[model samples]
Target: MNRLMEFIATGFYSGKLPKMPGTWGSILAAILLYFLWPTNLKFQLLIIFITFILSVISADYVAKELGNKDPDCVVIDEILGMEIALLGLSADIKTVFLGLILFRVIDIMKPPPIGFFEKLPGGLGITVDDAVAGVITNVILRLIGGLL
Candidate 1:
């Protein structure tokens, strides 16, 4: 059970990477997820939903164990959020680049309701805020893709 908890907490070992592990894990996961799956809207949305649900549930315990408010090692939320932002978008270099920038901006900025979710207790607070940011980024990406 202990090992199981750690595995989930660290995003199946991606969180354990040395130096900026969470960010690296997220980027790796996003890249793999983008390539491994069919580039379909429904598939991308499904991935986003699953990642969000799993991240929300697991993030709290991970944060508690790490003794930090959203520790850098607990970046499953970022991975899930980044995937969400890229959902249904073109997989071209330009599109992916924009998605990355947009997601990072929203995640970092945490404007309005996204910031509001950050105040919640435990892991819910930690993960949900990023989830909201991802959603916001997703909306913007969809809009930009439509315009282009």
Candidate 2:
């Protein structure tokens, strides 16, 4: 059970990658989203909700085990964030590519409310900032989509 949670928190070991594990997790999310993410908004919301629940559970477990808050290796947050970022957008290459980039940039920057959410404590803190970044990215993507 611990191992299972660890595996999930680690983004199936993608988070173990030496470089930019969150980025890797986001990329993995993109790949999974291509196949598994539903086009229907309702289904998308359901998936996001479920993923968020799993992310919080697994991330909290791993963080406690490792004695670290917001450990880099627990990147289920990135997966959740990526899902939110791409929500409702057309799954076309251009939209997805833009979403990936936008989410990554916003996540890295951690500006404003996104940064604010990082102070929440426990897994919620670890994850919500990225979720906020995802919301920001989604908005940006929507604006871009409208433009082009």
Candidate 3:
């Protein structure tokens, strides 16, 4: 059970990548999630809500076991966050690419409440910060979508 927990906590082997595995896994997850986008806003919201909840719990446990705060290997949070960022956007490749870039930038920069949220303890901190970053990315995407 311990081994199983570690494996799941480590993102089912995605975390074992030699370099930037989490980022790569997140990119892949976002790409996959883009294909799963529902036309209905309510459904999208439900997916995002459930994913966020699971990510917070799982990421926290992973970080604790890995002895780090928001370890790079624990990227389920990023996957969930990026999925949230892409919500309600057009399914075009261009929109997805733009959202991906925007999400990565906002996540890396950790602006405002994102930065504030990073100070939180445990997995809540790990996941919340990325969630805030995702919200920022979503806002930017929405603004751009409005303009174009």
- Output the worst ten-in-a-row residue range by lDDT, candidate 2: 89-98
TM-score of 1: 0.80
lDDT of model 1 at position 23: 64
In order, what lDDT does every prediction score? 0.74, 0.89, 0.76
User: Best candidate, TM-score-wise?
Assistant: 2
Q: Which is the better candidate, 1 or 3, if ranked by TM-score?
A: 3
lDDT of 3 by residue, 1-148 (tens): 2555455445566766889776675676667766877778898889778867777777777777777887777777777778778778765788778878888878877778788888888878877887888888888999998898
lDDT tens digits, residue span 28-137, model 1: 65676556645878877777777776776677777777688877777778787777777666666666667777877777777898978988888788778877877798
- List the lowest-lDDT window of 10 residues for candidate 1: 1-10
C-alpha displacement of 144 in model 3, angstroms? Answer: 1.1
TM-score preference between candidates 2 and 3, better one: 2
How many clashing pairs does model 1 include? 1
Q: Which scores greater on lDDT, model 2 or model 3?
A: 2
Tell me how far candidate 2 lies from the true structure as C-alpha RMSD in angstroms: 1.1
| RMSD of every prediction | 2.4, 1.1, 2.0
